[model samples]
Target: MPVVDIPGSKSITARALFLAAAADGVTTLRRPLRSDDTEGFAEGLAALGHRVGRTPDAWQVDGCPQGPPAREADVYCRDGATTARFLPTLAAAGHGTYRFDASPQMRRRPMLPLTRALRDLGVDLRHERAEGHHPLTVRAAGVEGGEVVLDAGQSSQYLTALLLLGPLTRKGLRIRVTDLVSVPYVEITIAMMRAFGVEVVRETVLGEDVFAVPPGGYRATSYAVEPDASTASYFFAAAAVTPGGEVTVPGLGEGALQGDLAFVDVLRRMGAEVSVRPDGTTVRGTGSLRGLTVNMRDISDTMPTLAAIAPFASGPVRIEDVANTRVKECDRLDACAENLRRLGADVRTGPDWIEIHPGASAAAGAEIKSYGDHRIVMSFAVAGLRVPGISFDDPGCVRKTFPGFHEAFAAVRAGLPG
Candidate 1:
């Protein structure tokens, strides 16, 4: 068995940074992911005058319950949607003028839902160029939170941004969500809030979901981030595709918090042997892969992982109900289709789904065109395991989440039989 040590969760680290920054005292984060996206989030906090101490093993943050220490700031959010969306909301709780911008790719993503909700909450927000996009400004005088409606159909990060800003307001927040995708991500948010000393009330009234958050701010505590389940999907897929091969990843067992961890169940359904224990999880190849249709709305981040390995299955693989993936780093559905076709696999895409037929020969070497998206690169790398001469146009893009992905993946591949 190849024991792979995956990095910490990007979603968890980002949420922990937000909670720590809004807490009443100092907070320490153990085993946080050090990647481009997370580094940009920490830098955004520093730009707002929060004290963050960094070491190899941990990151300590000096929380500011009264909001950011700075009165004015210009923040660059890089390509991290969490940093771009969450940081401005954090700055809104303080007294100042904060201008936020991002890379061209990040600027093109959806921002209107969160900004509109903030504007409805009485914050003076302006879009520097396009409406509902980045390169915006927030004139902050603190928030007097109350009832507001949000549509998180496009991105759950919009809802998460508002949820993180709840306790920082004077009057708390009562959010009525009209529609939501990725319910598990929101669940992770609520659970982490409780860890930092806040209990969010959830209820359904008149067929709509509502979240009631109290006005008291967070209490700081030492937090340990779990290994990223999404990142672990690649290694698990590797094991599932390689006959007689096995892979184990520690720190993501039955009690793991990330929804992406559920990808193993999808693998198990495809004929791989899976084991989930208290300390870790393992996947072993049984030499047979049976394809079937799967709905991956809540865990859409791993869609590409499944798509990459679909060519090796004995039947057609159909993935459905992941429309939100279109607005991610790239149009993942289309990207997966393009890459799978490039590998000579028969692929088809719909508005929100993909189907891959297993007749095409995927063993031939091909160049994968990575659209500056990390997931695109990582997912296609799995195909390189069986297909010789696989090359990537932009392999370095994995730095957004896992800077050392190639080396780690190479190690796992070297341990497996050819």
Candidate 2:
């Protein structure tokens, strides 16, 4: 058994940065992720005239109580979607002119839903180069925030961006979200907001969620981020795929805020033994992997991780209700299907679902194309544990979230039994 210490949650870290920047006083984030996404968020905040300082133990962020310092600035979000989507809402909360741009890949992702919601809230926004994509400008005088409706079917980040700014609005904020995908992430956003001293009132009206947030904005506080459960999935899958193998991801247990922690249940349904201790959660192989159909909408981030292990299952694995994954850093659904096929698995893909039949023999050596997606790179790396000669075309792509993923993954591999 290998006890692995994973990094902090990217989702929580990103949300904390936004909330801290918006709060009235100084806020400290302990054990926050230091990868590309989190760093990009910190940089974006600094560019807005907020003071963000890094120390060995933690990072301290000084809030812009009145509003953003800069009246006009250009933020380069790079490939971080959280930075790209969330910062614009923060920018709109201030009196400024802000332009957000990202990597070419991010330019292709959807942003209209959030932009439309911002417009509804009376923030002046424009798509500088593309109609519904990034490279957009926001001329802000702060949000009016009366009432707005959004279709969050594509990505939860849209809902989250607005939700983060809910309490900061002039007349408070009311949002109705239809076709919501990744509801767990929305829960994370609400929970984090509460941690910063604001409560979001949520109710279901005719199968749609209506959220009410009052005008009292967030108050700064010290927050500690839990280890990233999404990153833990690969190691947990490692245990599920290896006979007599066990891996413990420390610091993620029953009380963890991340929704992706439910991924262990998916492993449990596949016949792996899982235990939740006070310190962490551990997954142990039972010498059998059973494939089962599952709806991964809540934990869709783990879809590729599960897909990597599907070929070794005793039956076919079908994942459904994750059409949202198509609009990620890349078309993850297609990337997973194509990479699985490349590995010689019997794979079929739909607009939203993917079916993978167990392969009788391991495929020959092949290089998995990463598509510059970190999840894609890491998920397929787990498959390499069982299928030899599995190498990556862009192994460095994991730097987006987990910079030391390959080194950590190799340590996990080294601890496994032959």
Predictions in order: lDDT: 0.94, 0.91
**Model 2, range 265-364, lDDT digits (tens) per residue?**
9999999999987789999998899989999999999999999899999999999998999999899999998898888899999999999999835556
Estimate, for each residue in 221-261, the C-alpha lDDT of model 1 and write its tens digit: 99999999999999999999999989999999988889999
Q: TM-scores for all candidates?
A: 0.99, 0.98
With a 3 Å backbone cut-off (N, CA, C), the pairs that clash in candidate 1 are none
